[model samples]
Target: MSRSLFDVAQSIASVERSEIRRTTGRIARSRQTCCKIMNGSGSPPLHRQGMDYGESKDVQKVHAAIQREKQEPRVGLEPLSLWLIGIYALAVFFGGAYLGRFSGSFSGDSLDPGTVPTKSHGPGPGGGGQQQTAELSPAERGKKVFMSNCAVCHQASGLGSQSQGYPPLAGSEITNGGSRRAAMVVMKGLQGPVTVKGQKYGSAVMQLWESLGDLKVADVLTYERQEWGNHGGPVTKEQIAAFRKELASHPGSFTEADLEPVPADANLPGGEEGAAPPKPGEQAKPGAPPQGSVPPATPGAQPPKP
Candidate 1:
């Protein structure tokens, strides 16, 4: 607050003196103009009166220039607009490519319920069957599928190899059941499984056909159920489809162990249920027959009972 205070006061005085000098210069200019008139210079044409150029005229000209500039669009923005359009075009192209790649492999659409037969099926086991319809002809379709897929494993004529362990499809109880145990069995392949024919199959495990589309899977299965020397009912592709749909989330394929115990009413013998013919030593009742009423009795006939 000692020397600093004096220096600050001196600096303020110097700035005020400079500003006073500039103000006096402008006043000197005004006085010079008055002196010019007094000395007969007459102030050097203060404004050009009637000369087509004044402040108002200059302002009007500037307005017209601004309107002209507005009428013509600015040129620089065009390249910017082009850049924006290019970005939009690239976005659309990539979007289309993404959608195409995502949906291209959808497999739900290739289903064929009634597939054309490739080779001959000759004849099937059962001729007239219960009231039902087949997606594909059982004998023909089953034969083709069996030959193509199952025959390699189960063998031709639906008989599997004994040493190979693949069980026979022909005469399989799984194929010729009264109920739909056959279809259920096919849906879930067997392992260490006993078949409808009452035979134990221990060689190879059955495989699941889950990857086939609903219709094709159904058709192939329908073919198996009704093929060969196997007299069974026709299977529908829809039933197979529905079964697979129900099992879509199942962790693993079905196995014979998962099957419900074979029903008592399932796969009953085809004809009337009759006990086996009596063995020797079993006697016929009195008046049962005129000895040979059994018709063409065997040559080893026993002596007549008293």
Candidate 2:
């Protein structure tokens, strides 16, 4: 009975040893699978694994980027085309030819041969034997003179202040009057009542401009006659000179009564020419009325039909 019990105990100890070995093998396999899933490899601890491009999405993209960076970029100069080379060569040849033909010792005078080479005369009045030319016309010069001298009282527009006794030159009968009367007024001056353009003006004293030269006085008169719708024609320096001689004895200022009467057949230029008379049988064509002239109004005239 004692021998049988000892044999049973030995058999039980062998079975336990086999069971422990099987459990240890299963634990080792489980640890290997866990390491592979967590670390992306199943290599031994502390031993580096070869890079597996297909192992992970992130590793594959990184490897591709590195490979692209390592490749050298293509760079080189290409020779110019045959047509372009020929064009450049032609431009160079033409440019050289142009420079050689027109250089003119680099003095830059080859193109302008007509230019004066020497300074023979300075640019001034009567220089180079040329007559001194007046830049302003007589009327234009007279306009400047009137603005500076007469415009203060008469005004630039020549419409004087009637209330202040400054007479209007524009549309004035005195302006269109004969040059003799006009010249006398300017040289010797005038005073008291003066009717200009039908407006009665008085108590104003016009100072004499006797010191003004013949040309200046003549220009002023001419400007006054021609401007402001007063077409009395031009006044000449010769006319002013003759008038000055005639008025040599007259020293004092004149009144409105002293001036000569403007006749119907005045000697002024631009006067109406004699029109042809009506024939024996036919009615004559009516002449155009004179400028600034008004016909007498009938007592009870009806309005003309439009």
Candidate 3:
């Protein structure tokens, strides 16, 4: 019984100690508030109800740090260094040196005049070294020129529209007549009723193509000679030059009757079937011809009394 009474007393003392500590805490809090209001030794009360003021102030500092980090620029690709700059300078120097050594002074001519530039590593067809040139046959080159100039009227297949009055060049004698009369027609132009394959076309006028030049004329003629069903010989630059020289005085377009007589030595590869002979004395070699001067009229030869 005595021991039980002793335990009860110890519990009461523990309760009193807790009450004392609680009361002391309340009194100390009240005194601190009073001291703040009286402008004594205590700090002012915080505006926030339950939050810690010190910790709240520390939040602004943490926010400032975050804002500073946000304002800072982001890291990016590495800046060019001294070594990298030096390497770039060296590369530019070497590139300029190489180009200067090889480039033909950046002029109209290429690096090497003899060597033709081509897609293929081998030599070009015409032996010129400009890369624009392609390794193609004469017919192929001529086909391009023909399509650009003649295909409008002659059609892609060389079969001109009869109804439209565009004479067919597919099997026409003009194309196969060894490039003599044809070259003259191209250089000087043709007009009036022209008969091809027994069909006469008089509606359309064949315009002069002297602007196409000798090379283009030869190429176009060569292509026309070999294309379609025609089996005529290729026209050469020399043949065109010779014809142009021989007929230099004949500025006007030739009529069908004017181109009637084929020379005895006409360079017709497919023969004289429907082929018109060379213009009077303008008998030039097919591939090679004398510069100018056709066979002159027989000197002192009296004309037959009409």
Candidate 4:
């Protein structure tokens, strides 16, 4: 508790003690009456009844604090909510903009210079598989779809990290594609060394993410497939689950031949996709670079000192 609150409690306890009450009573009643009469009312008495003032200004301070607490907004998010939102927001925001720039050739079209998925080009070929449910946030509903399946090797970002022999998602060929094609790929994991956004990404067979139910898997796949510039179209949870059901007979990972790129103008991959490759001729900043290698673009991007 705050020091002021502690002091107020202490003062209240003291006042309740027999000795303190006796002491206050011993004070000249005539003098106490004179002070109250001078003020026209016994405000000090009323204040003590509510809360005792150990110091002269404590009563006002306590009342002010109560008033301030009452004035605060009731609908504000908690710290955890703020953090989850912040991380997801940053993933979509920075990740979207970053991915938009490296879309092979279609990078900036849908994710152009702003947030919010751009307009659609019309229902895709398999439009029946496009319906999505409103039950959960794209991320929340997508979690189950992602966990039982997606967490296998690509881990999360869909980009799979190099340390784990997976590619990065900040820029990935798969994330930079269309919906139908991406959904199919989700149902069937990827394989081989592939070229994403003009860069080569070689790898072993990846696990299939088709284990989730259609809506659950579809929504999640759609979310990951679309976010970060892999535009494509909406992958219904039903679509994903159905594919998983179909593939139940053979339980092995998929190869590169299993995937196909979505069409262009389909907003296939929606945004720019890629970590800004460090600029050439740029030096690392003072605190940049782990151990020994220099950081790219940390220098020279700054304007010359005035």
Q: Rate the local accuracy (lDDT) of all candidates.
A: 0.59, 0.70, 0.70, 0.55
* TM-score leader: 3
- In candidate 4, what residue range of length 10 has the lowest lDDT sum? 268-277
Q: What value does the lDDT take at residue 192 in candidate 4?
A: 76
Cα lDDT of model 2 by residue, 134-212, tens digit: 2445566577667757888889888999999988988887787656567667888989878887888868899888888
Of candidate 2, the 10-residue stretch with the lowest lDDT total is: 268-277
Q: Model 1 — which ten-residue stretch has the worst lDDT?
A: 268-277
User: lDDT by residue for model 3 over 1-306, one digit each (tens)?
Assistant: 999999999999999999999999999999889888687556666655533433434777656655655344458955679998999999999999999997777885342113224473446676464445434455666887888778999899999988877888888888765566776677777878889988888767788887766667777777887789876666766666666677668768777877788652356232222232243235656865333436557989987898
Deviation from truth (RMSD, Å), model 1: 17.7
- Candidate 3 deviant stretches above 4 angstroms: 1-134, 263-265, 268-306
**Count of backbone collisions within predicted model 1:** 4
Once fitted onto the true fold, the runs of candidate 1 whose alpha carbons sit more than 4 angstroms away are 1-138, 193-196, 260-306
Q: What's every prediction's RMSD, in angstroms? A: 17.7, 24.7, 16.1, 27.2
Candidate 4 lDDT over 217-286, as tens digits, reads 5557555655555543455444444545556785565555545433532332223222322333455567
TM-score of each: 0.40, 0.44, 0.45, 0.35
Quote the positional error of residue 236 for candidate 2 in Å: 1.2
Once fitted onto the true fold, the runs of candidate 2 whose alpha carbons sit more than 4 angstroms away are: 1-134, 260-306
